[model samples]
Target: MDRPTRWTRATVYPDMWVDPADDPRNSDGVSPDGELPTLVDYLGRYRATLLMKCDDLDAEQLARRSVPPSTLSLLGLVRHLAEVERDWRGWITPGAVPPRLYGSADGDFEGAAPDPSLVARAFADLAREQAATDTALAAHPDPGERLGADGIAVRELQVHRIEEYARHCGHADLLRECIDGRVGQ
Candidate 1:
Protein backbone atom coordinates (compact mmCIF):
# COMPACT_ATOMS: atom_id res chain seq x y z
CA MET A 1 0.00 0.00 0.00
CA ASP A 2 1.19 3.47 -0.81
CA ARG A 3 0.74 6.52 1.40
CA PRO A 4 -0.08 9.99 0.19
CA THR A 5 2.60 12.64 0.28
CA ARG A 6 2.24 14.88 3.31
CA TRP A 7 3.85 18.30 3.61
CA THR A 8 5.41 19.11 6.93
CA ARG A 9 7.07 22.12 8.54
CA ALA A 10 10.34 20.80 7.12
CA THR A 11 8.99 20.76 3.54
CA VAL A 12 7.23 24.11 3.83
CA TYR A 13 8.70 27.50 4.64
CA PRO A 14 9.72 27.85 8.28
CA ASP A 15 6.90 28.88 10.66
CA MET A 16 4.49 29.97 7.93
CA TRP A 17 1.48 27.85 6.97
CA VAL A 18 0.90 29.91 3.83
CA ASP A 19 2.50 32.65 1.78
CA PRO A 20 2.12 36.03 3.46
CA ALA A 21 0.54 37.66 0.42
CA ASP A 22 -1.93 34.80 0.03
CA ASP A 23 -2.77 34.42 3.70
CA PRO A 24 -6.42 35.11 4.39
CA ARG A 25 -5.57 36.22 7.92
CA ASN A 26 -3.52 39.12 6.60
CA SER A 27 -4.96 42.54 7.37
CA ASP A 28 -5.38 45.02 4.54
CA GLY A 29 -2.95 47.88 4.13
CA VAL A 30 -5.01 50.03 6.47
CA SER A 31 -4.18 49.48 10.11
CA PRO A 32 -6.90 49.49 12.76
CA ASP A 33 -7.13 52.94 14.34
CA GLY A 34 -7.99 52.66 18.03
CA GLU A 35 -7.81 50.13 20.86
CA LEU A 36 -11.22 48.68 20.09
CA PRO A 37 -10.55 48.39 16.38
CA THR A 38 -7.18 46.78 16.99
CA LEU A 39 -8.66 44.26 19.40
CA VAL A 40 -11.57 43.50 17.11
CA ASP A 41 -9.29 43.09 14.10
CA TYR A 42 -7.06 40.62 15.94
CA LEU A 43 -10.03 38.61 17.17
CA GLY A 44 -11.66 38.56 13.76
CA ARG A 45 -8.45 37.45 12.03
CA TYR A 46 -7.95 34.61 14.50
CA ARG A 47 -11.50 33.43 14.02
CA ALA A 48 -11.03 33.43 10.25
CA THR A 49 -7.75 31.57 10.56
CA LEU A 50 -9.42 28.84 12.57
CA LEU A 51 -12.12 28.53 9.97
CA MET A 52 -9.55 28.38 7.20
CA LYS A 53 -7.79 25.54 8.96
CA CYS A 54 -11.00 23.56 9.05
CA ASP A 55 -11.88 24.30 5.44
CA ASP A 56 -11.94 21.47 2.86
CA LEU A 57 -11.98 18.83 5.61
CA ASP A 58 -14.73 16.27 6.04
CA ALA A 59 -16.56 15.68 9.32
CA GLU A 60 -14.30 12.78 10.21
CA GLN A 61 -11.21 14.84 9.50
CA LEU A 62 -12.59 17.76 11.47
CA ALA A 63 -13.40 15.55 14.47
CA ARG A 64 -10.27 13.39 14.35
CA ARG A 65 -8.30 13.48 17.61
CA SER A 66 -4.93 13.31 15.92
CA VAL A 67 -3.07 14.24 19.10
CA PRO A 68 -3.04 11.45 21.66
CA PRO A 69 -4.24 12.04 25.25
CA SER A 70 -5.98 15.17 24.03
CA THR A 71 -9.57 15.34 22.85
CA LEU A 72 -8.88 18.47 20.87
CA SER A 73 -10.22 18.60 17.27
CA LEU A 74 -11.08 21.26 14.76
CA LEU A 75 -14.75 20.60 15.34
CA GLY A 76 -14.21 20.71 19.08
CA LEU A 77 -12.45 24.03 18.75
CA VAL A 78 -15.39 25.42 16.82
CA ARG A 79 -17.83 24.29 19.48
CA HIS A 80 -15.61 25.48 22.31
CA LEU A 81 -15.12 28.90 20.75
CA ALA A 82 -18.86 29.25 20.33
CA GLU A 83 -19.30 28.53 24.02
CA VAL A 84 -16.61 31.05 24.85
CA GLU A 85 -18.30 33.74 22.81
CA ARG A 86 -21.63 33.11 24.47
CA ASP A 87 -19.99 33.18 27.88
CA TRP A 88 -18.31 36.44 27.06
CA ARG A 89 -21.64 37.94 26.06
CA GLY A 90 -23.17 36.89 29.36
CA TRP A 91 -20.22 38.31 31.23
CA ILE A 92 -20.58 41.69 29.58
CA THR A 93 -24.37 41.87 29.73
CA PRO A 94 -25.81 42.08 33.24
CA GLY A 95 -28.60 39.53 33.77
CA ALA A 96 -27.95 37.91 30.39
CA VAL A 97 -26.57 34.70 31.88
CA PRO A 98 -26.88 32.50 28.83
CA PRO A 99 -26.79 28.79 29.54
CA ARG A 100 -23.92 26.66 28.25
CA LEU A 101 -24.44 25.64 24.64
CA TYR A 102 -22.84 22.20 25.09
CA GLY A 103 -24.15 21.44 28.60
CA SER A 104 -20.93 20.42 30.44
CA ALA A 105 -17.68 22.36 30.34
CA ASP A 106 -15.90 19.60 28.39
CA GLY A 107 -18.91 18.51 26.38
CA ASP A 108 -17.66 20.53 23.43
CA PHE A 109 -14.65 18.28 23.02
CA GLU A 110 -16.08 15.01 24.33
CA GLY A 111 -19.16 15.21 22.16
CA ALA A 112 -17.31 16.16 19.01
CA ALA A 113 -18.11 13.04 17.06
CA PRO A 114 -17.49 12.59 13.33
CA ASP A 115 -20.92 13.47 12.01
CA PRO A 116 -21.68 15.90 9.23
CA SER A 117 -24.74 17.26 11.00
CA LEU A 118 -22.79 17.80 14.20
CA VAL A 119 -20.05 19.60 12.31
CA ALA A 120 -22.61 21.81 10.57
CA ARG A 121 -24.31 22.61 13.86
CA ALA A 122 -21.00 23.51 15.48
CA PHE A 123 -20.17 25.95 12.69
CA ALA A 124 -23.65 27.46 12.77
CA ASP A 125 -23.57 27.86 16.52
CA LEU A 126 -20.16 29.54 16.29
CA ALA A 127 -21.34 32.02 13.66
CA ARG A 128 -24.49 32.89 15.59
CA GLU A 129 -22.66 33.27 18.87
CA GLN A 130 -19.97 35.42 17.28
CA ALA A 131 -22.57 37.73 15.72
CA ALA A 132 -24.42 38.07 18.99
CA THR A 133 -21.22 38.82 20.88
CA ASP A 134 -20.20 41.40 18.29
CA THR A 135 -23.58 43.06 18.57
CA ALA A 136 -23.31 43.16 22.35
CA LEU A 137 -19.84 44.60 22.06
CA ALA A 138 -21.06 47.28 19.65
CA ALA A 139 -23.31 48.63 22.38
CA HIS A 140 -20.19 49.74 24.22
CA PRO A 141 -18.44 52.21 21.94
CA ASP A 142 -16.00 53.26 24.63
CA PRO A 143 -13.29 50.76 25.44
CA GLY A 144 -13.07 52.19 28.96
CA GLU A 145 -16.77 51.53 29.57
CA ARG A 146 -17.34 49.18 32.48
CA LEU A 147 -19.58 46.12 32.09
CA GLY A 148 -21.47 43.80 34.41
CA ALA A 149 -21.50 43.81 38.21
CA ASP A 150 -17.81 42.97 38.36
CA GLY A 151 -17.26 46.18 36.38
CA ILE A 152 -14.61 44.84 34.00
CA ALA A 153 -13.70 47.28 31.29
CA VAL A 154 -14.78 46.47 27.74
CA ARG A 155 -11.15 46.76 26.67
CA GLU A 156 -10.14 44.09 29.17
CA LEU A 157 -12.65 41.53 27.91
CA GLN A 158 -11.83 42.31 24.29
CA VAL A 159 -8.15 41.74 24.94
CA HIS A 160 -8.92 38.47 26.71
CA ARG A 161 -11.01 37.29 23.78
CA ILE A 162 -8.19 38.11 21.38
CA GLU A 163 -5.76 36.13 23.53
CA GLU A 164 -8.11 33.15 23.70
CA TYR A 165 -8.54 33.15 19.94
CA ALA A 166 -4.81 33.45 19.38
CA ARG A 167 -4.11 30.40 21.56
CA HIS A 168 -6.80 28.33 19.89
CA CYS A 169 -5.73 29.38 16.42
CA GLY A 170 -2.30 27.92 17.09
CA HIS A 171 -3.96 24.68 18.18
CA ALA A 172 -6.01 24.68 15.00
CA ASP A 173 -2.88 25.03 12.90
CA LEU A 174 -1.36 21.88 14.41
CA LEU A 175 -4.62 19.93 14.20
CA ARG A 176 -5.03 20.93 10.58
CA GLU A 177 -1.54 19.84 9.73
CA CYS A 178 -2.10 16.50 11.38
CA ILE A 179 -5.27 15.95 9.40
CA ASP A 180 -3.62 16.90 6.11
CA GLY A 181 -0.17 17.87 4.85
CA ARG A 182 -1.54 21.26 3.80
CA VAL A 183 0.44 24.05 5.47
CA GLY A 184 1.02 27.76 4.81
CA GLN A 185 0.29 31.19 6.32
Candidate 2:
Protein backbone atom coordinates (compact mmCIF):
# COMPACT_ATOMS: atom_id res chain seq x y z
CA MET A 1 0.00 0.00 0.00
CA ASP A 2 1.09 3.52 -0.75
CA ARG A 3 0.25 6.83 0.91
CA PRO A 4 -1.73 9.21 -1.25
CA THR A 5 -0.27 12.41 -2.63
CA ARG A 6 -1.07 15.44 -0.50
CA TRP A 7 -1.98 18.97 -1.60
CA THR A 8 0.20 18.68 -4.70
CA ARG A 9 -2.51 16.66 -6.41
CA ALA A 10 -5.16 19.39 -6.18
CA THR A 11 -5.09 21.14 -9.51
CA VAL A 12 -7.12 23.78 -11.38
CA TYR A 13 -6.99 24.16 -15.11
CA PRO A 14 -6.99 27.57 -16.78
CA ASP A 15 -10.65 27.31 -17.83
CA MET A 16 -11.84 26.42 -14.34
CA TRP A 17 -10.69 29.58 -12.59
CA VAL A 18 -13.55 31.83 -11.53
CA ASP A 19 -14.09 34.90 -13.67
CA PRO A 20 -15.17 38.21 -12.18
CA ALA A 21 -18.18 38.69 -14.43
CA ASP A 22 -19.32 35.08 -14.44
CA ASP A 23 -21.45 33.65 -11.69
CA PRO A 24 -19.49 31.31 -9.39
CA ARG A 25 -21.35 28.24 -10.61
CA ASN A 26 -19.20 28.26 -13.81
CA SER A 27 -22.24 27.98 -16.08
CA ASP A 28 -24.77 30.39 -17.47
CA GLY A 29 -28.09 29.55 -15.82
CA VAL A 30 -30.87 29.59 -18.42
CA SER A 31 -31.90 31.11 -21.71
CA PRO A 32 -32.01 34.85 -21.06
CA ASP A 33 -30.93 33.97 -17.55
CA GLY A 34 -31.92 36.43 -14.84
CA GLU A 35 -28.57 35.96 -13.04
CA LEU A 36 -28.24 35.11 -9.37
CA PRO A 37 -30.87 37.44 -7.89
CA THR A 38 -30.11 36.97 -4.22
CA LEU A 39 -27.24 37.39 -1.74
CA VAL A 40 -27.45 33.70 -1.04
CA ASP A 41 -26.33 32.86 -4.56
CA TYR A 42 -23.39 35.24 -4.46
CA LEU A 43 -22.20 34.32 -0.99
CA GLY A 44 -22.87 30.67 -1.53
CA ARG A 45 -20.68 30.72 -4.61
CA TYR A 46 -17.88 32.37 -2.67
CA ARG A 47 -18.23 29.78 0.06
CA ALA A 48 -17.93 27.07 -2.56
CA THR A 49 -14.70 28.61 -3.74
CA LEU A 50 -13.35 28.51 -0.21
CA LEU A 51 -14.24 24.86 0.09
CA MET A 52 -12.80 24.10 -3.33
CA LYS A 53 -9.57 25.75 -2.30
CA CYS A 54 -9.27 23.35 0.59
CA ASP A 55 -10.45 20.20 -1.14
CA ASP A 56 -8.32 17.05 -0.65
CA LEU A 57 -6.17 18.54 2.10
CA ASP A 58 -5.66 16.38 5.16
CA ALA A 59 -6.43 17.59 8.66
CA GLU A 60 -2.85 18.61 9.37
CA GLN A 61 -2.70 20.58 6.17
CA LEU A 62 -6.09 22.14 6.73
CA ALA A 63 -5.18 23.21 10.26
CA ARG A 64 -1.68 24.40 9.45
CA ARG A 65 -1.42 28.07 10.37
CA SER A 66 1.15 28.97 7.78
CA VAL A 67 1.03 32.63 8.65
CA PRO A 68 2.86 33.57 11.82
CA PRO A 69 1.44 35.94 14.46
CA SER A 70 -1.95 35.19 12.91
CA THR A 71 -4.05 32.21 13.84
CA LEU A 72 -5.52 31.88 10.35
CA SER A 73 -5.79 28.52 8.63
CA LEU A 74 -8.22 26.88 6.23
CA LEU A 75 -9.68 24.98 9.17
CA GLY A 76 -9.84 28.13 11.24
CA LEU A 77 -11.54 29.92 8.40
CA VAL A 78 -14.13 27.17 8.17
CA ARG A 79 -14.85 27.48 11.86
CA HIS A 80 -14.83 31.25 11.72
CA LEU A 81 -17.26 31.33 8.82
CA ALA A 82 -19.65 29.03 10.64
CA GLU A 83 -19.70 31.36 13.63
CA VAL A 84 -20.09 34.30 11.31
CA GLU A 85 -23.22 32.85 9.73
CA ARG A 86 -24.75 32.28 13.12
CA ASP A 87 -23.90 35.80 14.27
CA TRP A 88 -25.50 37.30 11.19
CA ARG A 89 -28.61 35.26 11.76
CA GLY A 90 -28.77 36.50 15.31
CA TRP A 91 -28.46 40.08 14.17
CA ILE A 92 -31.21 39.95 11.59
CA THR A 93 -33.60 37.41 13.05
CA PRO A 94 -33.97 38.09 16.73
CA GLY A 95 -35.77 35.64 19.01
CA ALA A 96 -35.16 32.91 16.43
CA VAL A 97 -32.05 31.35 17.88
CA PRO A 98 -29.75 28.78 16.37
CA PRO A 99 -27.37 26.93 18.65
CA ARG A 100 -23.88 28.37 18.32
CA LEU A 101 -21.92 25.75 16.46
CA TYR A 102 -18.33 26.64 17.44
CA GLY A 103 -18.94 27.57 21.05
CA SER A 104 -17.28 30.91 22.00
CA ALA A 105 -16.86 33.84 19.64
CA ASP A 106 -13.05 33.69 19.45
CA GLY A 107 -12.81 29.97 20.03
CA ASP A 108 -12.94 29.16 16.35
CA PHE A 109 -9.61 30.82 15.67
CA GLU A 110 -8.19 30.29 19.12
CA GLY A 111 -8.46 26.57 19.68
CA ALA A 112 -7.75 25.45 16.13
CA ALA A 113 -4.52 23.52 15.65
CA PRO A 114 -2.93 20.92 13.43
CA ASP A 115 -5.12 18.16 14.81
CA PRO A 116 -7.24 15.87 12.66
CA SER A 117 -10.27 15.74 14.92
CA LEU A 118 -10.41 19.51 15.37
CA VAL A 119 -10.03 20.02 11.65
CA ALA A 120 -12.82 17.57 10.91
CA ARG A 121 -15.04 19.29 13.47
CA ALA A 122 -14.38 22.64 11.82
CA PHE A 123 -15.55 21.40 8.44
CA ALA A 124 -18.57 19.75 9.98
CA ASP A 125 -19.56 22.92 11.81
CA LEU A 126 -19.16 24.93 8.65
CA ALA A 127 -21.56 22.69 6.77
CA ARG A 128 -24.12 22.79 9.54
CA GLU A 129 -23.92 26.57 9.82
CA GLN A 130 -24.25 27.03 6.07
CA ALA A 131 -27.40 24.90 6.02
CA ALA A 132 -28.91 26.92 8.85
CA THR A 133 -28.16 30.19 7.12
CA ASP A 134 -29.77 28.91 3.93
CA THR A 135 -32.86 27.91 5.84
CA ALA A 136 -33.11 31.35 7.47
CA LEU A 137 -32.66 33.11 4.15
CA ALA A 138 -35.32 30.97 2.49
CA ALA A 139 -37.81 31.92 5.15
CA HIS A 140 -37.62 35.45 3.77
CA PRO A 141 -37.04 35.51 0.03
CA ASP A 142 -37.44 39.21 -0.50
CA PRO A 143 -33.98 40.70 -0.16
CA GLY A 144 -35.42 44.16 0.26
CA GLU A 145 -37.01 43.14 3.51
CA ARG A 146 -35.32 44.85 6.44
CA LEU A 147 -33.95 42.40 9.00
CA GLY A 148 -31.56 42.52 11.99
CA ALA A 149 -31.48 44.82 14.94
CA ASP A 150 -29.47 47.38 12.98
CA GLY A 151 -32.13 47.35 10.28
CA ILE A 152 -29.62 45.95 7.87
CA ALA A 153 -31.26 44.89 4.63
CA VAL A 154 -31.04 41.19 3.92
CA ARG A 155 -29.54 41.85 0.51
CA GLU A 156 -26.79 44.00 1.95
CA LEU A 157 -26.03 41.44 4.62
CA GLN A 158 -25.80 38.74 2.01
CA VAL A 159 -23.39 40.85 0.01
CA HIS A 160 -21.40 41.36 3.17
CA ARG A 161 -21.24 37.63 3.62
CA ILE A 162 -19.84 37.33 0.11
CA GLU A 163 -17.25 39.94 0.90
CA GLU A 164 -16.32 38.18 4.11
CA TYR A 165 -15.88 34.82 2.44
CA ALA A 166 -14.05 36.32 -0.51
CA ARG A 167 -11.55 38.05 1.75
CA HIS A 168 -10.92 34.96 3.87
CA CYS A 169 -10.69 32.85 0.77
CA GLY A 170 -7.83 35.05 -0.30
CA HIS A 171 -6.17 34.32 3.02
CA ALA A 172 -6.76 30.62 2.44
CA ASP A 173 -5.01 30.95 -0.90
CA LEU A 174 -1.86 32.30 0.67
CA LEU A 175 -1.95 29.83 3.53
CA ARG A 176 -2.44 26.92 1.20
CA GLU A 177 0.38 28.09 -0.99
CA CYS A 178 2.73 28.42 1.93
CA ILE A 179 1.80 25.01 3.20
CA ASP A 180 2.42 23.05 -0.02
CA GLY A 181 3.42 25.27 -2.97
CA ARG A 182 -0.04 24.83 -4.50
CA VAL A 183 -1.66 27.92 -6.01
CA GLY A 184 -4.36 29.48 -8.21
CA GLN A 185 -8.15 29.21 -7.96
Tell me the TM-score of each prediction against the true structure.
Answer: 0.89, 0.80
Residue 110 displacement in candidate 1 (angstroms): 0.5
Candidate 1, which segments miss by more than 4 Å at Cα? 1-15
- Residues 19-91, candidate 2: write the lDDT tens digits: 4454245656643322335455567668888987787788888887755788888888888998898887887
Please give me the total number of clashing residue pairs in predicted model 2.
1
lDDT at 69, model 1: 90
Question: What value does the lDDT take at residue 145 in candidate 2?
Answer: 81
Worst 10 residues of 1 by lDDT: 1-10
Pairs in clash, predicted candidate 1: 17-183, 17-184, 17-185, 18-184, 18-185
lDDT of 1 by residue, 103-145 (tens): 9989999999999999999999999999999999999989999
Worst 10 residues of 2 by lDDT: 1-10
lDDT value, residue 86 of candidate 2: 80
Q: Write down the lDDT of every candidate, Cα atoms only.
A: 0.87, 0.74
RMSD of each: 3.0, 5.3
Q: Which residue ranges in model 2 land beyond 4 Å of their true spot?
A: 1-24, 28-38, 96-100
